[model samples]
Target: MTFQPLEQALHEAIDWMLRLEHLPASDPAHLAFEHWHAHCAENRLAWQRVNGVLDSALANLQGLPGQAQVASRALRALANPPRRQLLGKGLALLLLGAGSVSVLNRLAPVADLLADARTATGERKTLQLADGSRLSLNARSAADIRFDTQQRRVVLRAGDLQVQVEPDLARPLIVATAHGEVRALGTRFMVRQESERCLVSVQQHSVLLSTADGSARRVEAGQAFAFDRRGSMAVAPSMRTRDDWVHGRIEARDEPLGELVEALRPYYGGLLRISPQAAQVRVFGTFLVDDIERTLASLGETLPIRVDTLGFWLTRIDVK
Candidate 1:
């Protein structure tokens, strides 16, 4: 009913659009966005505005020289309650061309570019640390390493990693994520930073897992745990087979179509999308991460799904 809430929702919708553009359709963020979009009339209207702006400007965005600057100014103006007028102008300038969106997208991963260690999509790496430890990074992953006299710490910025910690009584090895820190006690483990939480799976020995709230728990070998900033809140049977991805293979045992798409996203160089109906399908197999097209073709052969390609950057799956 109030213009203020509509304006707020508009801003939030734009932010969510930026994030969801790259996230898997099955991510909790996507579900949360669906909830917000359906919350009320104002929210839906705000989302409509976002889509309308993009639809109106995407095709005519060629050679808009000063559009990026104009968009930036208009976006700043929208922050001060200049809702309708400024928002309209900002979206117009921002979506006017693919170039503007390209600029913004580049700026999105600035931190990863400056990270100590990073792997691009479909790329993997094995690093031998100075402390006789081994660190393997998965696709689309970034990490920052900091070693000192007191502690050996790794800050995971995005994606997943496997760490094999060598014995070191002098310094405690810790892997830190947004949710918490996992202190490895001479163990081999895996850590994945998801949108809503961090998942830690121990392969050998135990680790002292602590959340931002100071709550701690022991995750033993053959155990997997998920936690948020509040603390270690969940435990599941460790899936050692998951580590196969480090070797360029994806092992999906009756995984949902949406989840398989999520796992394949980092390996493929495109916007891979699955329709809601097709996402409900179940997939089981080991696919090669490096050969996304072959894997998709194989999936199409066995499942009742259609794989459509739009250039080299967009792939969509829907019920046949």
Candidate 2:
């Protein structure tokens, strides 16, 4: 069928883009790419279509107020990965050709770039709001803070944040996400936005959580809760230990290898693949954020796993 042929072409186009995205202009790959691009009219058309989609997405992101510079830098980084390859790992292999458009839609790269405050991959930032409240963002996080006479609100567009509310009885402090809103009642809490739900962990005082459907609950201190548009779920006792990332490390406590790999993804500027067996293996340790390669090597040494590295932007974990 025509659909089958077009799908194959799209897959090929995606593969080609990934290969050439991080390659140097003078590399032999470019010569090969040029030949491939000019080989047939269909190939040319596919290339043009792919490029058009990326350009349009980039342009749309750049149009956001005060986001032009950040979006340009982010897009350029995606195009030309760094030689050290720190945090640019996820998109290349996972998002192939038209798939890139879908990834863009899900991640909302423009919204993150345009956020009032944002932290790049493997980077954390602390901000002091106008109301004297403290906001700490985790790596690869984005938040928009809007303060007016009516309320002090922070919209968590992506990732996680820890907020220490400054007591202001006149104006309530609220944190909003895709799932719902958490109203701070002189509380300190952390909100992490996962795929379909948001996790709210209250550390001090209590927070009033309201779902999209008008259901509400007061999450007290020492509790961790998750909620989506539908409603809030059961609450669990809070962890006595703090998030290790706050201390510039990742602490894995009998965690699946895949979970650790995902946690490390934001710090790696490469494509990483974990075999099914490798992902199922359990790991526990503290990995220094700055030494990701060493951490991976340690995994290979201690477990029945192999860490395979191919060039600056490719790594794979397979069963030994």
lDDT of each: 0.72, 0.72
Q: Mind giving the per-residue lDDT tens digits that candidate 2 earns over 135-204?
A: 9987678899999999899999888788989999999899999999999999898898889898898889
Tens digits of lDDT, candidate 1, 1-320: 88567667766777666557658777899889989888899888878877766544433333455454443432333222223332333453353333445432222222365578876545678898879899999876889999987789999999899999989988988999999999999999999998899898888999999998978999888788889987665564422226777788888787678878888777664457899999999888788877777898888889999999763345799999
Q: Pick the candidate with the highest TM-score.
A: 2
Q: For model 2, what is the alpha-carbon lDDT of residue 97? A: 36
> What TM-score does prediction 1 earn?
0.66
**Cα miss at 318, model 1 (Å)?**
0.9
User: What's the lDDT of the predicted structure labeled candidate 2?
Assistant: 0.72
Highest-scoring model, lDDT: 1
